[model samples]
Target chain A: MKILVCISNVPDTTTKVKFTDNNTKFDANGVQWVINPWDELALTRALELKDNAANGITAVSVIHVGNASSEPTIRKALAIGADDAYRVNAEPTDAYNVAGQISEIVKSEKFDIVFCGIESSDFNGSTVGSMVAEFLDYPSVSAVSGLNIENGQTVITREIDGGKEVVSVPAPFVAIVQKGIAKEPRIAAMRGIMQARTKAIKVSEPVAIDSLTEIVTFELPQPRAKCKMVDAENPKQLIELLMNEAKVI
Target chain B: MSVLVFTENWDGKFKKSSFELASYATKVAEMLGTTATAVSIGNVDDSELKSLGNYGVKKVMCVKNDSLNVHDSQTYTKVIAEAAQKEGAKVIIIANNNTGKALAPRLSVRLKAAIGSGVNKLPLSVNPFVVVKRAYSGNAYAQVALKSDIKIITLAQNSFELIETPNDAAVEAFAPSIDASMVKTQLKDVQKQSGKILITDAEIVVSGGRGMKSADNWAPLSELANLLGAATACSRPVSDEGWRPHDEHTGQTGKIIAPNLYIAIGISGATQHIAGVSSSKFIVAINSDKDAPIFEAAQYGIVGDAAKVLPQLVEAVKELKGK
Candidate 1:
């Protein structure tokens, strides 16, 4: 069985967000890029499943819907141990367009399972995975925290309102995973990084599609007011402030 | 022609989020000179359905499908899309919760609608259908313009206020055709976390971090949480170090919550951690380092060791509650 993990190139979690072009576009200047944290975890889980020969997972491949500038992120996925990678040559305009591009790749690849992070840290749209499943007419399980192949059947654990539910899904499905899919993302070993330079990163042109939504502008949240400090010795004063001043208690 | 809101019921009872969605949809409908209709799936009774009227819903479509007792995104999408078609709903609103997160994108595809996920406000313009939502985590906001004829919006929880506008809404039964093949996944078991409040649903959260010192120090934090009826959370490092469960981790990579009151104890407020929680209506920080970044985002702060202050705070809460 082959697994395809969809990864996105996003600004590092610590990078201060800025807007350009009158706040219509994200400023990418001097921003560090990394594989989306969730996608990295998904890829790590896929690789772990592949590591165990008993799981019958033959190969794990990574795919991204981005321009050439994101190839470094894609190569980083390769270093983390994907067999190969696919980079759709297009700017990820919106969730719909990105999902359509991914669906095109899934149609040709015929992977048994596809993984997408629940949401990217940038757009936080949380739409692409299920949209891809809808486009492919495949079953999708979201909020997946645990995925295991038991007796050749895929067992999935998803978090719901109060608790969690475990389910079994048939193959060729989408798993929209969140945290706990893997203990932690694996760091690429030196040898793996060396080998990643030689691995094949197939570039495919994006399928023609129009984004359903457009970004009108970007605005930063208003700066927070200076914090009102209460002395540690007078902890009760803090409580009174919460009740009377903040009225949040 | 009308605004449709998908209200999710837990064991046949609607939560605050459902009512908030109803209220939001009503306001949006008012903006567009139309009425708001709500669609409920699962075992909600007529009286319970009519209660949505308290939030300005004029009509409710109740779909009592046994197959949909548990959420299957595919079937739920199909059922909601059919309801939207029947109502000629130009705008569809859903809560940006787990169910909505899973269902909205598929509905967007099925209904050929543009989705504005996690939208925090009403349409900036009704003609163009633009909505504002948090982007780049909570560090920035984006105004999204929907170009499609039909628009689907996932309302961020706690972002909108629930206005009680009683209208005595009419509850009508809705039966959408469900294909058996749509049930692809078999639910084997369910495990509900009991007793403790879920952070996502909690109005207030009391979170700890590495500065809490050790797992043993969580008792006072838990006591404060219990006193205030708040959920307990931890920073990513605390969870990573196994001092707290991964489920309790709240950061950019963990749960993104917007509670009414977030009391962050000992958390230095990394950019990522702040990203997850900056949506909180009010933040109170307690840390030894006065210069911790958390104080910058907090409304109120105490510059002291969490160990020295936590017990006192807990006692103060108990006294305030007359315990």
Candidate 2:
């Protein structure tokens, strides 16, 4: 079985987010970049499925919808054991455009399943997966916590408000993995890092989309008020403070 | 110029966030000098739908259908898009829950509107169309401008303050012309994990991390959760160990929740873990490491051992409840 994992380059979660130049765009200076945490789950799950395949999964390929600046991220995905990588040579301006490009790629590759994070840590929109699925006319499930592949069908467990739902879909579906499905993302080993450089990195152009979502400005959240500490060894005092001072109760 | 809200319901009961989103939509409608109407689908009774009027809704369009109860995304999108068009709603609001997150994008395509998810604040500019949205998974804020004639926005769970004032309104039963093809995917079964309340709807949540020592000790935490009528969650490490189901994992990778009271025990708040629970109204942290990053996020913190704190907190809750 062939799998396509979509990865996005996002600012590391630890970065203190800020905006510059009248807050029109995110400030790029002094920011460390990493593959989105949820995307790492998708990638790792893709690898696991490949390793556990009975008929022998051919390869796991990583794809990113971004410009040349995102090469390192695509390379990192390869180093983490993707057999090859593809970088769409375009800046992702909107989720529709991103999905359009992936749909075009999906048309050619005919991958058995596509994997993506529930949402990018940066955009946090959680749209691209479903959009891609809709564009391809394939079944899609989001926030999958458990996955099982058997008898040419995949069973996935997802959460709703009061309970859980376990759904099954045939192969050639799309799954957006959330966190908690896998342990810490495996780090690229020395041998895998060396092998990644030799793997093929394909580039593709984005398809045309007339409409797009726009970002007007980006800003840091208002600083939280300073924490008010209470005296320890006195539970009643803390309760009093919560009732009288904070007035939350 | 009317505003539309999708009332989230599960098993024929409206979720609290639905009323909260309706309250928010009411304000947005008032800001635009128009009325807000709600569109809901489920097996909900009309009398229950009438209660939505108290949230300042002028009317409630109840789409009572059995297929709607399971939250079929494709069918929902078709129905909601038609409702928006029929009502001539310029702005649509929905809770940023799992269903809303799945439906908003599809509705955007059908309505030809620019969509924004995880919206936290009111529009900065209504004319040019800007709303502040949570970025970097709530670590930062971004103002998104939807340069379109129609707009759809998903309000972040627990972001807006809810208000209550009575309004005399009518509940109108509306039937949507849903295509059979839209209901292509069928729900086989719903397998819910048995434990505390579902995290998204919980008023109080008690979460732990790797510091709980072993999975066997989870009983006390569950006991405390039951006492408070709270939900039980875990950091990534606990879920990784299979001590808890991944669905109950609250962190950057798991479900993002915003309960009224979040009591985190033995967990050092990693940025990833905090990403999911940052919107909780009040946070209480209990950890041995005083300098754990979780302290930075908590409103009230206790420096102690979980082994000692768990039973004590359970007892405290039980005493308070007289149970």
Judged by DockQ cut-offs, the docking class of candidate 2 is: medium
Which portions of model 1 show Cα errors greater than 4 Å? none
Residues B100-164, candidate 2: write the lDDT tens digits. 87778777766667888888778887888888887888787777888778888998877777777
Error of 1 at B304 (Å): 0.5
DockQ of each: 0.87, 0.51
Error of 2 at B72 (Å): 3.0
Given the true complex, what DockQ would model 2 score?
A: 0.51
- Give Cα-based local distance difference scores for all models: 0.93, 0.80
What TM-score fits each model?
Answer: 0.98, 0.91
List iRMS (one decimal) for every candidate. Answer: 0.8, 2.4
lDDT of 2 by residue, A132-152 (tens): 776776767766766767665
